[model samples]
Target: MLSIKTFKPYYVKEEGNYIRVVLAFQYFSLLMDDKVYQFVPLESREIRINRETQAIENKDAVFVFQKGKKYNRITLRDLMCVKDFQDHLSKILSPYMILTQPKEKRDEIDYVIMELEKINLLRLIDLALDEKDQIKFNLYTEKLLEIQ
Candidate 1:
């Protein structure tokens, strides 16, 4: 069975009107068009990291979608319908200027990442409709708050 996991995109690369986001398992691209929404899969994409510039690239990757039932087109409306999609997108796309600086700047990036995760956890707490889940959320929040 195929498993799905939600993750903040590892990195993004822009080419023309297309933007490719490297996820944990694959490279997913989105065409920058207001009228349509779809994620194109770049197969056999080789990731290369430039040591000098600290840049990443997908070498020999074709800018095309895979063909089959599994590659069914996804619409913007469809993505919006998923719970917390907006929150996820907001967190993922936030400016990462802190990451571009030297290693000493990593702490700032780490803090941002932590804050986003905390916000997400709080949102999940709101979505926990059951008493059992609510209790778990309460405990988790208490523990998290203690640390903070």
Candidate 2:
């Protein structure tokens, strides 16, 4: 079964042509590839990071979506879509960058591998929604603040 237990929720920023709003929340699927299956509140795609480095022994992160199915271990840097088809897109961030001048344990760690075990810190990117997409976000954020 494709279980919700397999995914992690995260919020992210997204930029669009007409407007911009937070993605509210999204789901990252733990898979052989470091990929995200985003539930975008607006019309945009969300990006997930892979935690494994074995499948990518000599490659970088990637995402693949064709027909109505999503794929992992993709090798592309970017994907584009028009406004009409916006909403709930999948993606992966590859060629993971180790930005530190000095090496760290987190460097070169495969994001896909850790996701399967439930603890991970992959660099997932969220899409900010454009207004006219949802009317309940403000209320949601307020509720979040109450608990925090």
Candidate 3:
């Protein structure tokens, strides 16, 4: 029987309208006929999935497996027939498929947060000055300097 022993994406990348997932030998393995076979990428380790369709785009991508120096190559499509394999793969890839803000948007959010922190600190510093709290004033000033 064929079964998944380990399946974890080595890294995920967003490419245009697809998510490219790379799998390395160490991250993916299969158990077949009571023997474990580690997946080794022969030419390409990339598995591309359409963002809209969620279907694997590189079904012909080849992977190699070795057993005591004997190597075997198989296409990704061949593994799809294994029971629940697609379901398990979908589950593992789901986390990586969630939409994330682009770098520019993330940077904008960080800038806004920093500005708010600066504004809040300035108000606290003013309050400290009014109350004649030298220790609080010094602390807020130090924090403001660090932020800048």
Candidate 4:
């Protein structure tokens, strides 16, 4: 039997008004199961360590969740155990690289990515200013201006 031992999030970040949580899973398959499956966190790569800041900038490193009434009580485990959760995780985790994808599909992904970057930049600018860090605040402002 397949069973989940634990579900832990490695990293969580905010983009605009949404929360993106990156989860690492540990599972097991009992002796009766025909196929054994296991996830050993210590033996594998740290999901966030290999990723760079651009993972957030380009919006591909974590699963995005909107902040609102409906999803308020949901836990990381709840999300992970939901039906078709792997499909949802697959969609979020896939590296939708522009060069490798089909020509026709590239445009849509590129446009969405560019737009997400802009929004993320604006959010960073807001945070910098709020924290009174003139250097980063000014830097983000300049980047946004350049984008315009």
Best by lDDT: 3
**Stretches of model 3 off by over 4 angstroms after superposition:** 96-148
Tens-place lDDT per residue, model 1, 55-145, is 3344434333333333444443444445554555555544421234677588888989889878877776667644558687887688668
**TM-score for each prediction?**
0.27, 0.16, 0.61, 0.31
Preferred candidate (lDDT higher): 1 or 3: 3
lDDT for model 3: 0.84
- Model 2, position 73, has a per-residue lDDT of 34
Query: What do the candidate models score in CA lDDT, each in turn?
Result: 0.48, 0.31, 0.84, 0.47
Candidate 4 has its poorest 10 consecutive residues by lDDT at 64-73
Better of 1 and 2 by lDDT: 1
**Model 2 lDDT per residue over 9-37, tens place:** 25433222111112223343322333434
Note the residue pairs that clash in candidate 3. none
- Candidate 2: segments with Cα more than 4 A from true spot: 1-5, 18-27, 31-148
lDDT of 3 by residue, 1-148 (tens): 8777887889888888888888899988888778989888877687889876778899998878766787777788987877666866788678667566789999999999999999999999999999999999999999999999
* Model 4 C-alpha lDDT per residue in residues 6-84, reported as the tens digit of each score: 3344555544433454454332211113433333333321233113222333223222222222111223344345545
Instruction: Quote the lDDT for 60 in model 2.
Output: 38
RMSD of 4: 18.2
